[model samples]
Every structure is written in C-alpha cells, then in structure tokens.
Target: MRAVITTEAGGPEVLTLDDVPTPEPKPGQLLIAVVAAGVNRADILQRQGHYPPPPGESDIIGLEVSGYVSAIGAGVTGWRVGERCVALLAGGGYAEYVAVNAGQVTRPPEGIDLVEAAGILEVAATVVSNLDAVRFKAGETFLVHGGTGGIGMFAIQYAKARGATVLTTAGTPEKLDLCRTLGADTALDYHDDWVDGVKEATGGRGVDVILDNMGAKYLTPNVRSLARLGRLVVIGLQGGVKGELNLNTLLGKCATVTATSLRFRPADEKAAIVSRVSDEVWPLIASGRIAIAHQTRFPVDDVRAAHQQLTGGNHVGKVVLTF
Candidate 1:
C-alpha cells in the first residue's frame, strides 16, 4: 500500500507518497479499501507540525474517507465485506487503505457517487456536533465565518435546512454570493467590519449561535455578535490562539464559549456523533433538504498539490483526494 507521509514539519512540499505497510483491522475496527479521502485544514496543521496525531493513532493526516469495507475486525457486526462506506477518523485517511472503528463508519446515502461522498462526513460531523452543543433551534439566526470553505458551505445549508436564518462572512464577493446561494440570509465581507454587518443583519439583537473557525482573531467580535444566551463554538484556530475578552459583556449576555476538535475526541464520543450524522444528517441529504456542497478532486499521488489547493484558499468547497 501507498500512503502520504510528511518528510518534516514544513510546507505542502513536505508531503510525499510512499509505499507503507497496509494496516490490519484491530478489534472493533474495519479495514477500508480507500476510494477517496477528504483534505482538510487540520491536515495542513499536522503537515506543519502544529498538530500531532493523538496517542496510539496513525500519524497519517486525514480525518474522513469514503471506501469499501474490505475486512471487519472481531466484535464488529452489521457490516459486510465489499459494502461501500464512509468514516470519521482520528487519523490515517490519506492512503490506499485505512483502518477505522466500525462504530464510526457510515454508508453514504444511496444515489450519490461514492467518490464525492468522501468530503462530506468530516465537515457534516463537525457542524452537527458544534450546533448540537449550542442547542441551536429553528427560527434562530446562525452565523458562521468562512462560509465558502468546506465546513462553512455545509454549515450554511445545514442551518437553513433546520430552519435557522443563516448569516456568513467571506473575503470575496463571489464567495459571499455563494454563501447566499447556499442559504445565508446575509453575507458579510470578512475584509470589512463583519461584526457591524452582523449587527445590521440582525438589527442589533445578535444571533443565537456562531460557528467560528478563526479562533482568537474573531473571539471578541464573536462575543459581541451574540444575542442573549447565545453560544459560540470554536472549531478551528487558524487565527492565533491567545485572545482577550470582556467578562462583563459575556456575563451581561449570558453567553457561553466552547472550543472542540473532532479529531481529538475519544472513540466512543466520535461514534455517537457519527451515529447522529448517519441517522439524522444523512436523511436530510438523501431527501434533498441538505444539498451536497461543491468539491474538487485530485489523484492520491498529487498529495502536495491537494495541500496547496486547500492552503491557497481559493477552492470553493471541499478538496478531496481520489484513490
């Protein structure tokens, strides 16, 4: 089997495809013959040495994949060899084969191409878990940053599908338009005072939930953009980690702040999220309530170019690697 390995902590150039031993399924896991893999922002972090794989997990840098179940580990049932499936992972997705926990695997909704399904689960699971934490409800207004990115695109449509009035921020006009097309009620320019735009969009009452990937760079404003009792879930730290906040304002609004990494979660917890996604979100997708976000695919051998495409920040949706 061939897999991508980072030669050192550095740029996309550090990633190289090389022959590696194919893994056998551990207890309660499944060995998947990879069809395609999702490339994500976290992959860049790992490639640059900013993020390391969790202890005892594969050092490979992918968080989701679509593949066929080639074998099942002991104690796993309800799965058969040769069934097409997808999975959320702690690591080890960028390869010809990956071993994932059976509890974390899902069959993609029928009728969608198995290859395009690769990029959907990781972002869907991320959005669903964060929104579920916030208790986001119908009729509430939701705001997400980077609305044209993988997570952002899905977040926009998923929130709308659940009946929330959606708001988003993007750096380019075309990107902002796509956000609106995906169901955002308002699209603000990230290059401008986006918080002010949020205020204007909501008529100053603020939003009920915020899905922020910018971390410290948007922390204060995200707080300022919340309505009373609002929740802010930070799922990325593309911005610097350290930030200042006004305790007085947070208290006044009765708002809460949380940060989570799907890749760092315990297996049982990830299994639960994956279950929710398969049972709930997948239906929405199957019924056409939630549309598939756009995607760009590259052959697995072009791993460096895939990383460059993601880091370049111009790709409209999920960047994927085809086996």
Candidate 2:
C-alpha cells in the first residue's frame, strides 16, 4: 500500500507517497479499499508539525474516506465485504487502504457518489455532535464561522435543514454567495465587523447557537454575540489558543462555552456520534436537503497539492484526494 507520509513536518513539500505495510482490521474494525479521501485544515496542521495524530492511531494525515469494505474484523456484523461505505477516521486516510471501526462507517445515501461521500463523515459527525451539545432547536438562530470550509458548509445546511435560521461568515464574496445558496439566512464578511453584523441580523438578540472555529480570536466577541441561554461550541483554534474571557458577560447572558475535538475521543464515543449522524443527518442527505460539495480533487500521489489547496484558503468546500 502507498500512503502519504511526512518526512519532517513543515510544509506540503514534506508529504511523500511511499510504500507502507497494509493495515489489517482490528477487532470491530473494517479494512476499506480507499476510493477517495477528504482534505481538511487539520491535515495541514499535522503536516506542519502543529497537530499530531492521537495516541495509537496511524501517523498518516487524513480524517475521512469513502471506499469499499475489503475486509471486516472479528465481532463486526451486518457489514459485508465489497460494501460501499464512508467512514470517519482518526487518521491514515491518505492511503490506498485504511482500517476504521465498523461502528464509525456508514453507507453513502442513495444517489450520492462515493467520491463526494468521502467528504461527508467528518463534517457530519462534527456538526451533529456540536449541535446536539447545544440542544439546537427549530426556529432558533445558528451562527457558524468559516462558511466556505467543509465543516462550516455542512453546519449551515444541516442547521437550516433542522429549521434553524442560519448565519455564517466567509472570507470572500463568492464564498458568501455560496453560503447563501446552501441555505444560510445571512453571510457576512469575516474580515469586517462580523459580530456586529450578526447581532444586527438577529435584531440585537444575538444567536442561540454558534459553531465557532476561530477559538481565542473570537472568544470575547462570541460571548457578546450570544442571546440569553446561548451556547458556543469551539472546535478549532486557527487563532491563538489562549484568550481572556469575560465571566461577567457570560453570567449575564446565561451562556455556556465548550471546546471539543473529534480525533482524540474514545472509540465508543465516536461510535455514538457516528450512529446519531447516520440516523438523523443521512436522511437529509438522501433527500437532497443537505448537500456535500467537493471543491477539488487530486490523485492520492498528489497529496501535497491537496494540502496546499486546503491551506491556501480559497477553495469553497471539501478538497478530496482520489485513490
């Protein structure tokens, strides 16, 4: 098997396609023959030495993939060899084959091609878990940052499909338009006074739920951007990690702040989230209420180019690497 490995973490140039031993399915896992893999900002961070794979996981840089089940491990039932599936992986997706927990794999919805489904698992799991934590309700307001990115694009459509009024921020005008087309009620320029824009859009009440990726850079304003009893779920730290929080503001609004990561979670927890997403989110995808977008595709051998496209920040949806 050929997998993308980093010689030393620094830039996309470090990514190399090298022959590596094929991974075998562990108990309750499935060995998938990769058809396509999704590229994420996390992969870039890992390549640059900023983020490492979780303990006991593969060192390869990928988080989601769509493929055919080539083999199944002991204790796994109901899934068969040659079944088309997509999976949320901890790592090792940048390869010809990957072993993932059976509970974390899902069959692509009817009418969705495997290549597009490659980008669905990570975004679906992330958005579903965070929205579940916030107790998102129909008719409530939801705000998501980085509207053009994979997670943000899915978050906007998923929230809208659940009946929320979705607002999102994007860096470019074209991206903002794409967000609106994807069902966001409003899309604001991230480089401008986005907080003020969001507040104004909601008649100064702020939003009921926020899916934030900027971490410390938006912490204070995120607090201010919340309505009473609002919830802020932070999943990324594109900004610096450390930031001051005003306890008084949170107390006054009865708001809550939470930070979470998907890759480092326990196996059972990941299984639970995957199950919930399959039950709730997959139907919307099948019905076309929620759509998966693939902005670009590269061959597996061109993994470095895939990483560069993601880091360049100009792509409007998920960048996929084809096997």
Candidate 3:
C-alpha cells in the first residue's frame, strides 16, 4: 500500500510518497480502504514537526477520512465489510488503509459521495462540540471568526440551522460575500472594525456567543464584543497563545471563555463527540438542511501541494486529498 510519509520535517517538499505495508485492524477498530482524506491546518503543523501524533497512534498526518470498511476487529458490531463510512481518527489517515475505532465511524449521508464525506468528520465534530459547549439558543446572535474557512463554514451553517442568527468575520470581501450566501445574517471584514459591525448588526446588543479561532490576539476584542452572560468558545489559536485576560471586565460582563482542541483528546472523549455529531448533524446532512461546500481536491501523491495550499490560506473551503 502507498502512503505519504514525512521522512524529515521542514516544508511541504519534505513529504514523500512511499509504498508501506497495509495496516490491519486492532481490537475494537476497523480497517478502511482509503478513498479520501481531509487536509487540515493541523496536518500542516504536523508536517512541519510542530505537532506529533497522540501516544500509541500512527504517525500519519490525517485526522479524518471517508472510505469503505475492509475488515472489522474483534468486539466491533453494527458494521461489516464494504460498508461506506466516514471516520474520525487520531492519525494514519494519509495511507491506502487506515484502522479507526468502530465507535468513531459514521455512515455517510445517503446522497453524499466519498470526497465530500472525507471533509465532513473533523469540521462537523468540531462545530458540534464547540456549539454544545456554548449552549446557543434560538434567536441568539452567534459570531464566528474565520467564517469562510473549514470550521467557520460549518459553524455558520449549523448555527443558522439551530435557529441562531449567524454573524461571521472574513478577511476579504469575497469571503464575506461567501459567508452571507451561506446564511450569515452579517459578514464583517476582519480587517475593519468588525466589533462595531457586529454590534450594529445585532442591534447594539452584541453577540450572545462567539466561535473564535484567532485566540490571544482577539481576546480583548472578543471579550468586548460579547453581550452580557455571553459565551466564547475558543477552538483555535492561529494568532498566538499568550494574552492577558481582564478578569474584571469578564466578570463585569458575566461572560465565560473556554478553549479546546479535538486532535489531542482521549479515545473515549472523541467517541462521545462523534456520537453527538452523528446524532445532531447526520440527520441535517441527510435531509439537506446543512450544506458542505469544499472548494478543492488534490491527489494523495500531491499531499505536499495540499499542505502548501492550506498553509497559504488561499482555499475558500475544505481542502481534501483523494487516493
């Protein structure tokens, strides 16, 4: 079986396509014949040696995939050979075959293809878990940073479907328009005074929940942008890690801030997130209530190109690698 391997860590050029032995399913896991895998920011980080796979996991870079089951390990049920599925993974998705825990696998929506399903698991699970943590309610205003990116796109659609008014921030006019087309009530330019824009859009009341990716750099502004008792779910810190939080201001506004990363979680915890995503998000996709718009696909051999594209931040939506 062929797989992409990083013989040394540095740039995308460091990645090489190599023929490796096919991996077999371990207990409670399922071996999948790889069809497509989603390329994410974490993949780029892993490639550059900034992030490593979790303990006892494969060194492969991908965190999610869409494929057909080739074999099921002992103690696994409700699955069989040749069943089409999308699965959340700790690593090893960038290969001809991947073994993922049965609890982390989900059947693709009836009409969606493997390429589309490949991009679903990670973003879907992330959005669902963050929104659940925020506990958004109907008629509330929800603000999402990086609205045109992978997780932001899913956040926008899911927030709207859950009856919240979505307000998103994008860096360019084109991305802002894309957010508006995807059901955002307001799409503000991240370069401009986005807080003022969001305030105006929400009738000066401020947003009730904020899904933030720009962590420390946006911390002060995010706190200021929140309404009374608002919740801010920090899912990524693309900007930086260290920032001073004004505890007094946070207390004055009665707001709460929480941060999480999906890749480093324990298997049981990831299983729980997958279960929730399957129950809440799968039906929406199956019924056409939520839409996934992936803008690019690269062949598995061109995995380095995929990483470069993601690092350059030029792609509008999900970037997937096909086998």
| Superposed Cα deviation of residue 74, candidate 1 (Å) | 1.0
Query: Tens-digit lDDT track for model 2 on 209-307?
Result: 999989999999899999999999999999879999999999999999999999998888999998998899888989889888756999987887887
Please give the distance, in angstroms, between residue 271's alpha carbon in candidate 1 and its true position after superposition.
Answer: 0.9
Q: Which stretches of candidate 1 lie over 4 Å from their true place?
A: none
Candidate 3 lDDT: 0.88
- Clashing pairs in model 1? none
Q: Evaluated with TM-score, which candidate comes out highest? A: 1
User: Which regions of candidate 3 fall more than 4 Å away from where they truly are?
Assistant: none
Cα lDDT tens digits for candidate 1, 48-121: 99999999999988999999999999999999999999999989999999999998998998778888899999
lDDT of 1: 0.92
Candidate 3: tens digits of C-alpha lDDT, residues 1-323: 98889887889898998888898888999999989999988888788887899899999889999999999999999998999999999899899899988888888877999999999989999888878777878888899998888898988999999999999988888888899989998999888998899778877888899988888999998998999999988877788888889999899889999998898888898899998888888888888888886658999988878887886756788899999
Candidate lDDT values, in order? 0.92, 0.91, 0.88
Candidate 1 vs candidate 3: which has greater lDDT? 1
lDDT of 1 at 284: 87
TM-score: the better of candidates 2 and 3? 2
Model 2 residue-pair collision total? 0
Better of 2 and 3 by lDDT: 2
- Give the clash count for each candidate: 0, 0, 0
Measured against the true structure, the TM-scores of the candidates, in listed sequence, are 0.98, 0.97, 0.96
